[model samples]
Target chain A: MVKQKGILYDSTMCVGCGECYSACKKQNKLPETNSDFLKDHLSANTYTVVEQHGDLYARKMCMHCAEPTCASVCPVKAFEKTKEGAVIYDAEKCIGCRYCMQACPHQIPRYEWSQVSPRVRKCVLCQNRISKGLPTACSEACPTGATICGDLDDLKIEAKKRLSEGSDKYYQHIYGLDEAGGGSVLILASVPFEKLGYTPNLPKQPMPQLTNRVMEKIPTVATVGGLFLGSMYWLTKRKNEIAREEKEAKFKRNEVK
Target chain B: MKNSNASKLSFWKIVAAVIMICGLYSSYIRFTKGLGASTHLSDSIPWGLWIGFDFLGVGLAAAGFTIAVMVHVFNIHKFEPIVRPAILTAYIGYTLVVLLLIIDLGRPQNFWHPLVMWNLHSVMFEITWCVICYSAILTLEFAPVVLEKYNLTAPIKILRKISIPVVILGVIFSTLHQSSFGSLYLIVPGRLYPLWYSTLLPVNFYISCIAAGLSMIIFESYLNARAFNLGLRLDILSGLAKIVLYVLIIGFLVRITDMIITGKTPFLFLPRTETYMFYAEVIVGTFIPVYLLSQAKYRKSRMWLYVISIFTLSGFVLNRINVAVTGLVASSKTSYFPSFDEISITMMLVVLGMWAFKLVSTKFPVFVELENLKEEKLPEDSREMILSE
Candidate 1:
């Protein structure tokens, strides 16, 4: 079995260079929107953005969750978590209900709302290149050793090593290590994640686990509820029939008398 | 009387025709120009007016199953008079829902994919199947009405024999789907505001819809009375209103209790737009109607009953909209307001439903008087004899 690949992004080492951003756009074949790169956030045309928060810079992209809420909520199985740890999308299977957009905890998936036939746009962690034994475009293009791509298990050890060695400067946490149930991509920031525009207070448990608790009961409810209702109908109808029969018998006896 | 009826119908027909034309044109533009040009939806907010309207349509049409359970499974014969109309409204409402969904889907042609592609984990998947099943059930429940009009005794007899089971299945399907609508929001706790989000959201949806469904039935009763000149059955209408009152109280209690338990009660006091909308929804839609309908005099009076029903119905609409829209505003970077085309299409759908209801009621024996004629033709005692066997 192939080991699951992952990315470790150390925000303290990032230099706010546009190389990763340009590499992402080039690799994805996305058109330029002519918007200011610094002022712009992620959109249909931009898969990766290097956002500057004060003096520290953080790169925003898909979290590639181990148990993605988007994949769970899609009715048609449009999203899949590949063996290599990348969460890929199949536009062919999507009916565009946009439940994935709503269900995503990170809100990373962007839609091509402008096109006649729109598909959800998001970072796939360069699954295509990874499958061909190459590093991700963004990670390869990084000049500083800010972003590294390798096996997820190794990345976790590396993240812990950095956190312990530089405990003074670091926030004493890996942002995506257990956030939203542990995504493949992990981040180490100097400041708190919320200050860097990352959503805070995400539950440690997987987001899909919350909804699955309710969804798992659907079959039982349907079957048991159906049986109960069926029996109630039968019992009620029988009781009504017995009452009518008694009334009919009483009327006949009265007539005969 | 004939002239007046003709004038009223013609006026509505003109209005429906005009709206339908505009709607068809808008749909043409939508299909040709794409959702980007035609709708206000964006990547940040993919669901907008159409989704909110879909929720409204399903919530209002909830009467189909509620009335079925009341008259058939529970054997509440007094409500039998309104059952056919309620089912008809649901059939129409569901048909409109399906239509709107097709238009809203990015790939409308692939709408049938849900049947073959099974994702049991998804609440949407469950809802899709339930909707298809319940729509069929609605057809089966309402078929006898059309069959009775043609005096098709054989199918009518068969349908009557199996009516109990059919109604039971309908109720089961409705319960699952109605609650599952709230389940759609469950995965979005981070996005949806705390004031509306809760683990018991499905229960809240199921409870509120019961009241909304009952309110719809009452509102329809008054409209049928005026339109068909069938004098309003104040007895039946008041009985329904009384039930609505109890349901409203239950819904209110569940919501408030859930809020307090979840510690969301304090958020209700926050001077925010969502908080204000929540207050409006609870106050205008729930509390006022509950208070007025609780009074015996108000329940007995036709005008007061209608007013209360309207408030309750609008409250249901507001609640659905707030859940779909207002609750997500804070988290979403982009603010959404439906474009003119979106609003017109929704209006067109409502008008189409009204027209369809009018056409069906006028052509078929929908009223109680006509149903009495059929009952007289086949005596109740003989039907009971057939049933017992």
Candidate 2:
């Protein structure tokens, strides 16, 4: 029903300023994490973070994958990639299996570890902000326009343009372009993505694609297999039992004689 | 029925109730205190002793399906005496698995949600349904024993008439879910180490279950001999071991083929802890037992047969843990290790399951034939009388 696309972030243009992190926290109403070493709330409550790597700073959040592992494995249908390309979570439907936590390749989803009934917390791409014709909290807060939000095709064009002209600075690869089946959130980084904490070895094909193929066999295996096996067991046992009965009857007749 | 002392049952029942109460308390803590506080599970290692023991309980309990297949399907008259007791063991073991699952679920209350709102795509969802249906099938298949114990001959006859269909269905369901348990991890291909990953995981699981199930029956028969003071039935044990050895040979060969086809042969040759463990399972669990059982002299030796049973069980446990936990070594966020509380809770469930089994066997006609007991006892008594003269 609703069409979906997302932002492509060029990490090379990003300044190490905490503007996006603060804006996201403010927008989401997340509490500030008071870790002694790390003052950023993005580790827990803030949905996205800006990590400082040497002279460059990378913007990190949910990749909004086309075939999300979280959505596939969530025993309860909690984590959903909405038609509009936002990977959203509903706390009400959450079973707290943390299967989403286990399934996620990027490890983007965070849980309230201390709570008895914890919910998975992650980015929804500031859907409320975008509905009001404004960019995401981090995108609006950015001074250099490093974080660009738009349609998928538009972002791809932008990414390719930057890759071709800015070869001296760019890594030639467009991270998340084909990774995990073309996620809504794309990243164009100057350095190797491994340094920025991206899963470099992840298969380009979506995680869900692999499992969906495997799961398609469940109906046949569970129902049809059950029936066939059950029937064979029935016939064999009945045949033997009847033979045993006949033998016993003959033994009784002989004894009577 | 021979041990129909009400006082004895009541005494044991009280002990059982106390143990169950403690397990319930641990379970309550598991739910209320969060997994971090209740068990040794961590983000890196979400599964622990409960999963391992679940595999152990299921593998050991394979006796039920194997014995059922032998007595009913294959019409193996020699193993008929073992069929009822084997079914009872299976019933007990499955009940334990259900209990362990509850303990492991982060939200146990939401467990029924899968049934209420089905997830047809989820292998775990399918397994949940299969186990439930199969357990019911087993109950129906085993009902004649309970009816006969109560002297309900008419109902027992009716049950016997329909038992063929029920048992066939149960076997099929058992096979499906047994393999589906392995397919459950197919979702984590990227996370699961290549050493253990195989598109043929479901097939591998089913084969191992068959081998484990047969060996378990052999092991249980030995336990019965010791417990009941019935001298070991070397003939039956050896016969059963021969079957286990056959199944293991097929299963091992399949595994080797799978590894080779998947190009994971390099992993087996390469030095790694998981690879080494895999080798140990293949060698000690399947190969050694196969070789020993192949020899007429070794198969006849009671001590050697017992040793093979232990090896088979260890191998079974290792294979299951590899599928459930060890396979996910690459994706593990932290070092996965079982915690102390997890071990205790796991032990608590096992002890309870065993105690329940003991109570049922003593009170019910689980071991239906006392002819073997009588036949053996008469010889010793007569020999003593002649010696005194």
Candidate 3:
């Protein structure tokens, strides 16, 4: 069985050096979007960035949820959650409906709006490197070891160890540990995650499960609704036919008189 | 006015011709320049005017199923006169939605991908399939009108025999997709404003669409009478107007109760554009229409009925816009208004829809089968119910 890969980002250790940002660009062959990385936002070209929050820094990229909303909402099934734990996209299969952009709780997906044939874009979590037993581009390029890669179980244990060891030094919560039903990428921050510009208060339920719950009932609705209408059609047709027959009988009796 | 048809057609024809030319040019630029250059859309605002217009079209087009159920399923034969026009409006409305979707898609060439690609979990996938199925059902429903004109009795007989089943399928498909359109936004609770977002969104969409669909039928019937020089069926329309009133009350109650029960009424008092727009939608779409419709004179009068329908339609448009665009503003931190290219294309499509309606009404027996003419008498209490104004 393929072991699930993961990344644990210790934002306190991040020096805002932006080595991972450049590494991601080099690895993905994306064009240079900004000379200063701090001002850069996620875009079709730039998949990840180091954001400075007062005294600390964090990297913004795909959360790689265990069960992703993009994969759920896409009509064409263009997004897939791979065994390696990366949610990958196939532009070849994309129809550019942008439901992924609308549905992503993190608002992470960007679009190639300038192209005639645009594709939704986001970080792939370095699926190619991880599949070959290599760490992700960002984790490999972290000079200070802020971003570390390992099996998801090992990473969770490691994140818990650091949080327990330095209770005063870190916030009590792991940002992505159970957010929207948790993702492979977890963050340990010195400040409250929301203060560090993280999306907070997400429900523990996986986002897709919210929509799927209603979707599961559709078949019953269709079948039951069809039966009800069919029964009504027959019932109403019979009633109308009887009324017509009574009116005709009266007309014939009057004519005979 | 119906007798002055040639002059009326000429003026509207010139206006439509001008809009069509501009729309064609805009479409060319949109395809060539791509979304980034052609519209004000961005990563934060992936949807804009086109999507809002789509909601309007799909919502209004719902008359197809509503009238079909009334005549064919329930066997309320009094509504048989307006069934053809309602279906034609629906056919045109769905066609407009497809055209707009193609124009708005980043990869227009891949429009058919949704057919073979199945994502049962996706609301969009469900809506797409429903629209496709409903469109086919609509075609079958409308076929007899065209077939009768060609004196094809054999096919018409088959259509007549299968009419009840076709109407049933059409209603089921319409209910699924119309509600699902609201479900499309359920996944974006954080982005959509609290005033518009609720777990009952699908229910709200379904109930409100019934109101809009019924209003659209009223609007079209009156317009058809004015266009074709036919006598107005005040009894039938007033009966429809009463249903619209009850639906408006139910829709209003659902929305208000949901907001209060979910503790979203606080968001209602916020000083945001969304709040204002929500008020606008409720007032124009719900409150005023309900108020005007409740009055005997307004419900029965030809001019008042037309005004009330327009108000209800405008309110629906506002609610959709608020749901699609305005609600996301506070979270997105960016406001969006459609660009000229977007405006022109939408206008062009609407004009094209009108032209199609005109052509089909003139060419086919769209309202020729007035088989149910027992509706000449108005209700005794409906004072000032002018037959044709």
Candidate 4:
């Protein structure tokens, strides 16, 4: 397997500038959703947005989890996680069931609701650029190196080093490192991740595994259930037949006597 | 007599015409525009009335397998007479579900993708396969009678030999998908309100549906009795209602015990709008029906039994809606009510199903016992007699 690529975002260093947001739009060829990036949220049109929580600015986008719930729950297998660790989607394969939307722990995918033939739209993590050995548009546009893109392994060591070096300056935990079975995107925040608008209390175990545990039992349930019903039918039918036959024989014996 | 029959038919025809026109218009809008224009759904809340109703449709249809297993599997011939009608109701229910799914889908044309593409991990995939499988079995189970209509003894013979195994398969498929509907929500525990969420969801769904489905059969029987003038034995309905009582007790115990075990008692949270729905579902749906049906007087009376079944069926409706829509409102952060198009289309489907049921029951031999059909009646003769009536 190829080494997975990941994005490292340092919330302590972001400057509330809208450069990364605008760069994302340009890279994805999406129209400007809002004039002010601070007010913008993730939408069908907007892939990434910079949110300002008091003085701190945090970027919100797809987490690109190691085992994505979207990929697992899709009946058509529309969502795929590339070797680069970016979870991507194929519009052609989608029947637009939106189970992915309901199933996503991060709740990242957005539907193109206006179009008659709508497709689920979300960040592809600049998969094309990553394939070409280049950084994502957001990271490239980040002036302060607040957001960096590289191999996930290297990013993890770097994130841990930053945590140790600036122990007093960070929250002492890397967001997304183990949350929902650890996404490729890692975050270093000055405050708790939840305070910065990230979802809280997600299990370290993967979200899909919870669903898979039940799904994997289907074949066995079907087999056992079928066998039980068949046997019940046989036993009941045979018992009723025996009762009928015995009654007929007794009536014949009484008549002969 | 002929004059009254003609006028009555015309009256219903007019009513059907009005519903169909309005429903077709709403459906037109749903197709031309998109789900965004037709529904109150948004990015935050992707599912709404259609998905909820799908759950209700599939849940109520559980009677097909219940009746089938009772007659074909358990050798309970008392329920054998109502099996055809139950199967017909189920076939219509599933067809309506498929239609609604198409209307609700963003890419309706790509609906067939699920047939070819496989994701064994998805509950949706499992449900899809099961529904398709069950619908086919329903057709097979109902086919011999239709073949008997035309005196086609050869195909009827083949259907007879395979009938037992086919019914067993139908029961198996029904059990899987009915519970899988509840399993659909298991993945979204964090998003769904905890009161309705649990590891025992599939079990809860299965048992509750069994109760609701038997109630549906009773409810349908009363309507059939009135419309077709068929005197279904009171004892059969009583027998079925008794089964419903036992099911209700089991279902209530499972649900209440699960709630206690999961520590999601409504007492934990202050009462809200959803809390009222929970009360309506549990009390009106389960408690009142169970209390009334357990008594011999209530169970024996046709009027009391009819009303009790309605109460139980409504409770089932409320529960499905609560699970699909109301429970997620807190997480969605957006209140939702169905759009005019959504409401109209849903109404249209119900009316359409009722109309189809009438047409089929009248044209074919749906009520075998009441018609005195010991041996299959000649199709040509029965057709004339039925039409004259």
Candidate 5:
């Protein structure tokens, strides 16, 4: 088995029931999180949430991307992409640098602030449950089946089938289908994703793709720079040597004369 | 190392002990209370005083690498006496950055993730690696003095033999990381206010660091003369001031070009704090310094040179903070100010760095002008051989 899988969520069908949020907390043993704005809006404990749109609802979670920026930017290999297409973080190794937070395009990674030793909190897509052949808590608890999980190919087909059936009920776009180098989680909606707080400006290319051209040149610059400096040193030393020798010869000639 | 006519033995020792105790207490709070509790940082302002000071400290300390390159690589023997002190200043500044980073990191323990995970694309990774490497190079380059202090003559001889290569390596590393610091903000194009954001951020950072670094050396020299009654060398300092003038002029030119190209010049006139800071940074930091250093008589004055350096240093500090926090916070909809604990911790770290520098310089013979053996009285034939080598 390739182990790569993901979820497709249709926001048009979401009823704002929030069964997915409650189910996720129970299944994952997550502590109770109050999403009230009165407190700090961003935190480490609540990995995912249900966002409200004008007439629709959307689920916000980690994208589990094929090209994960968080994984790429992490210096210590603290973030690992499992074969099952889940980007898992090892708390034991995380140094709390927050570089991952800066790199993620969707801004999915949340920091644990209330605790003494905070860890990065994010949706892992329940890899443990998936390994045991069970649906994630959100999908299982979804009353209207707004969320579905399966192979990426199968999810694409399911999304297409809904789009073609058209009836003007579903929008023609899938939110994460190709955004940020193809995230593991996909979305379908009647309204446009931007209206639901999804970032429409993210590039289709992977985050690192924009930076690789620059990173590749770092070593070359260092090497050539080193050589140029060394040569200058050699030349300057030679000039000083010549000047000193001339001064010595002049002193000796005067003495002999 | 103790001065014969110096003040009471108990006074300086007590001061050092008191500073050490305060620093230790601050460190304890930082470790036990967590960053949020100990720091004034919030989501709106991720970076604060520590980051601000790091830029200021490192930018001023750029004198270290710049002087090293001139003396060792460019073979400017005129700057030879100042090289070791400059390098030492850079070493301390870089070390402080690491200390500040530890306090800044939310999970200080996970700091190793960047090295182990190999995030090859992140600018932060490049910066982290470059800083670590450069610090090592600085340590190696400064080792000859330590070796000589301990009378380890063989290692000193070997270090002299490799000094050229080490200096070259140090220059390369410093350039990469200095620009990398600016590049760290490049990816945040959307978040960084338009006034501070520029495609030429890396280049701007490099040039400004060099200019600020030169000014710092002049300022430090002035301070030393006053504090220790060291002889003032007007010839070399004025020569350095000229270079500083040229760099400031170029830096101002670049800032203007960047603003025009990015069409951010219009924003400079807007009724906003960023606009105000933008002008303050450019006008006060660059333009004024350029004007001050341009005059021959002004450049010759130790007092005026120090004053201009202080202004230049302040401008650099404000520019960094404006970009990293002030400009950013205004847009993010939350006002972030460092709590008392945060400021205290930052001050404590700075005090520690100052004390460490004083201790090291007092004990070592770094700033002394040691004449070569060839220049000393010796047998003529042997002196000729030494001179040739």
Candidate 6:
């Protein structure tokens, strides 16, 4: 069986070396923008960034949720959660609605807005490398094991171990373990995840589930509601026809009398 | 008098021509230069004025089904006169919405992808289908008017036979999609502010749209009366206002009750921009119109009715804009303001719709009284007949 792969990011260990940033650009073959790389957030050209929160450094990218809202919300299924545990995108199928960007709980998806033929851009967990039995470039380039790539189950165990063993250094919580409903990526930080600019108030339940609850009712509503409306037309038409007949009959009886 | 009317028409024609020219140029820039260069949209705020206007268009177009239900299903013959124009307005409104969607989409050529691609979980997918199906339904419902103009008696007879079922389907489609538009926001509870977000968002949207739709019918009637020299049907206008009043009451109660039940009422008192906008939307859009229309004197008066309808329509516009734009403001890092080109294109669509409506009204029997319609046998070549006149 193909194991679901994921990344464990240890913010406490990251040295803010900018190695992962350079490695990611090289791996993705994206042109380096002239803008200050340290100051940049995720964009069409940049998928991952190492954010500095005071003294500590954190890596920010797609959370790649177990039940990704972007995949669920895409009308064309352009985004798919692969068995390899990466949420990959097919630009060919994309109609460029950019709804994926809107529906993402983490707001990680970026768009090539300036291009005449734009594509929704974001981290795919380096699916191509993972499929080829290789770790992501950022993970392989990290000197201090700050970013580790492995099976998601193993990463969860490792994340918990670090949190419990180094309680003095690491924050008690694993950031992505249950955020927006159990993302594939896990983060162990010394400071609160919110201090690292993480969205603080995500529900434990998956965002897609919120939409699905309402969307699942559509078929039932269409069927039952269609029947009700159809019957209403019949009933109202019948009532009007009977009323017309009765009026004519009464007029005929009066004429005969 | 004839020359004055002709001058007035020419003036409008010139204005529409200028707007359309500007719109075409903006659209050219939009298509060639791409979304980044043309509009003020960014990754954080992906949807902007175009989407907001799309919401407004759909909300205002709610009249198509509301009037259809009243006249055809409930057998409210008094509203029968306004039904054609209501359907026409809906058709024009929906056409503009589809046009805007195409313009907003990054891959406008791939607009047809939704037909074969099935993502039933997405509200947007559902909405796309509903709009398509509803537009076809609107076309069928409005076909009789076109048929009547062309003096196609046989098809008219057939259409009349199927009209009831057609109307029922129209209402069903409108209901599903109108509420589904609200459902579009339900996924964004994390992003949309608490003041505007609710699981009951769909229900609120459905109800408010009914009130707004009814008001639109009244507003259009007033416009039709002024533009076409048709006498104001005071009785019909007053009756519609009564229905709008009832809908407004129900909508207000539902919204307030939902807020209380969900324990989100405290958010209403928050000293936030969204909170103030929310108050303005509810008070000016809903409460004031309800109060004015509730009075018999205001309902009977032409000026009061016109002014109240405008207020109601503005309130509805504000509500939609709040949901689509304002509510999402605090969450995004980048603030969005629509560029000049964006506003121009929106204005162009409005002018285009108005021009088409005027043209059709003149060429067709859209404003004819239902009672008088039976007495007139129009020529087969009505276009030529009108031109000759």
Comparing 3 with 6 on TM-score, the higher-scoring candidate is: 3
lDDT (Cα atoms) of all candidates against the true structure = 0.87, 0.74, 0.88, 0.87, 0.77, 0.87
lDDT of 3 by residue, A177-209 (tens): 898889999999988888877887788889887
Candidate 4 has an lDDT of: 0.87
User: How far is B71's C-alpha from truth in model 4 (Å)?
Assistant: 1.0
Off by over 4 Å in 1: A238-257, B1-14, B368-389
For B1-389, candidate 3 gives per-residue lDDT tens digits of 77697888788889889999999999998899888888899999998999999999999998899988987777777777788889999999999998998899888888888899889999989988999999899999999889988999999999888887788889989999999999998887778888988878888999989889889988887887776666677767888899899999999998899888988888888886777888999988999999999998998898889899999889888888889888887788787889999999999999999889989988998876442333455354443322110
lDDT of 6 by residue, B120-226 (tens): 88888989999999999999998888988778999989988988778888888899999988998888887898888999898889988988988898888887777
**Model 2 ranges with Cα > 4 A deviation:** A34-46, A127-134, A222-257, B1-25, B231-233, B370-389
Candidate 2 local lDDT, A1-257, one digit each (tens): 44566888888888767677778889999887644312353444768877766777777788988888888776666677776778888877665666677667777777665566666789988877665556788877888888888777798889999999998989999888787776888899888998987777788888776667767776676587566555655676577667767878999999999
Angstrom error of the Cα, residue B138, model 3: value is 0.9
The segments of candidate 5 whose C-alpha lies over 4 angstroms from its true place after superposition are A1-3, A35-42, A53-55, A157-173, A189-194, A246-257, B1-23, B107-117, B255-270, B370-389
Q: Report clash pairs, candidate 2.
A: A230-B168, A230-B169, A234-B164
> What DockQ do the predictions score, one after another?
0.68, 0.34, 0.63, 0.58, 0.42, 0.58
lDDT of 5 by residue, B1-389 (tens): 46643555567667767766766776777788777667766544556777777777777779889998987787776676678778888988888889888777877777766666676677777888888888998899888878878999998888888888888888888888887777776655556788887767887888889988987888877876666556655666777788888887887788788889878878877998888888888777887888888887888777888898888887887788887787777655678877766776677777777777777776887767622221334331221122324
- Per-residue CA lDDT of model 5 for A46-121, tens digit only, reads 6668877665777888989888878877666678888888899998877777767765778678776555687888
Report the candidate with higher lDDT, 2 versus 6.
Answer: 6
List of chain B TM-scores, one per candidate: 0.93, 0.88, 0.93, 0.92, 0.89, 0.93
Which docking band does candidate 1 fall into? medium
Model 6 spans > 4 angstroms off? A238-257, B1-10, B370-389
For candidate 5, the per-residue lDDT at B59 reads 76
| Per-candidate TM-score against the hidden true structure | 0.94, 0.86, 0.95, 0.95, 0.88, 0.94
Model 4 stretches astray by more than 4 angstroms? B1-15, B266-269, B373-389
**Clash statistics: count for each candidate:** 0, 3, 0, 0, 14, 0
Per-residue CA lDDT of model 4 for A7-118, tens digit only, reads 9999999998888899999999999888888998899999998999999889999999999989988999999999999999998989988999998988889998888899
